[model samples]
Target: MDKFKKVQDVIASVEADVTKFYEGGNAAAGTRVRKAMQDLKVLAQEIRAEITDKKNSAK
Candidate 1:
């Protein structure tokens, strides 16, 4: 749970940065922002996998 929260916090922080860059109107920054978003998605998937494994193991 703590690890999951930490990942969520990182994703939220990166998302905020992405929004800032996009609103500032920098094309190159937008590319980086998009890449960060992609990474956040992967983090989310990993967190979900961890949760699923815990659930399956409990049974």
Candidate 2:
């Protein structure tokens, strides 16, 4: 639950950064935004894994 919350927060932050980058019109910002988005995606996957592991362990 806590991990999911943290990941969700990170995702929100990354989303905000993406929006800022899109509005800023800087080429270099694109790379940073892409990287942040990728990291957030990976964090989401990790959160899924954590939930799955918890479920499996309970069973």
lDDT of 2 by residue, 1-59 (tens): 77667767766767756766789776676777788667778878888898899899999
Model 1 clashing-pair count: 0
The alpha-carbon lDDT assigned to residue 26 of candidate 2 equals 67
What does candidate 1's lDDT look like per residue over 19-51, in tens digits? 767688767767777787676788788889999
Worst 10 residues of 2 by lDDT: 10-19
lDDT of 2: 0.75
- The CA lDDT of each predicted structure is 0.76, 0.75
Q: What is the C-alpha RMSD of each candidate to the true structure, in Å?
A: 2.3, 2.2
The parts of candidate 1 lying over 4 Å away from their true place are: 1-20
